[model samples]
Target: MSEKSRDINFLKLFGKNLRSIRESKEMSQEEFSSFCDIDTRQLGRIERGESNSTILTVKKIADKLNLPIKELFEI
Candidate 1:
């Protein structure tokens, strides 16, 4: 209904999709974060939709997961 709401919804969806993809690969948050060289707490926040991630960070995650960046946003 509002721009802010839309953004929040997008973040939630992205987080959900990311979490699903990560879990599907059978990787724990700690393991994936280690592989991606990202902070585990930050990854947890991203997966919970509690924070917004930079494109660079997203790219790093995609690269580590061997997935296209766009796939992270898929519903």
Candidate 2:
């Protein structure tokens, strides 16, 4: 399909993976956000694939989760 469509799909998949990881860790969005020093609403937006995240933001998430950066991109 189109480039935009591919980007959207990537975002959705990333969000789904992130949500799964968080749930597996038994952390609520609020708790994860606080630990990551991020806003809860913004974390929700990211998890919902409603926002485009920067590398830095992703790094922060990976760091907070104690996961490798590459793991964040895993489907």
Candidate 3:
């Protein structure tokens, strides 16, 4: 795969994992975004794999979820 393709694949996987985890916590996207101190729209984009989120944003998410940063990337 091209590098861009690889990155897209990874983003999709990460987004899937993040969505699963968030749902497992029984939090709506709005609630979770508020908890993570992020914009609800941005969180939605991240969950849909449409945004290239920053590491700081990722860290904020993981922190809010009480998970390690690596957990966000788990398949």
Candidate 4:
């Protein structure tokens, strides 16, 4: 796949996973960001697919939320 297509797919998946997990944990963006040590603005960007997070950041979020990265994409 082209880089653009890959980016689109990945971004969509990431955003979807973020919303699902946040809801599951009963976390508002502010709450989740506090748990994950990220700013609410950054979390909003992530949920909107507007920011590309680093692997370490993603891992921190997954750990903070008590989820595996794979489970983050679960439907």
Best by lDDT: 2
lDDT per residue (tens digit) for residues 10-66 in model 1: 888888988898899899999988989999999899988888999999999898878
lDDT of 2 at 67: 88
Which is the winner by TM-score between candidate 2 and candidate 4?
A: 2
**Native RMSD of candidate 2 (Å):** 0.7
Alpha-carbon RMSD to native, per candidate: 0.8, 0.7, 0.8, 1.8
Which tens-of-lDDT digit does each residue in 1-75 have in candidate 3? Answer: 899999998888888888899899899999988989999999888888889999999999888878899989878
TM-score order of candidates, best first?
2, 3, 1, 4
Model 2 residue runs over 4 Å out of place are none
Best of the candidates, TM-score = 2
Candidate lDDT (C-alpha), each: 0.89, 0.92, 0.89, 0.83
lDDT of 2: 0.92
Q: Enumerate residue pairs that collide in model 1.
A: none
Global lDDT for candidate 3?
0.89
TM-score of each: 0.93, 0.95, 0.94, 0.83
RMSD of 4: 1.8
lDDT of 3 at 45: 88
lDDT (10s digit) by residue, model 2, range 1-75? 999999988988999999999899899999989989989999898889888999999999999878899999989
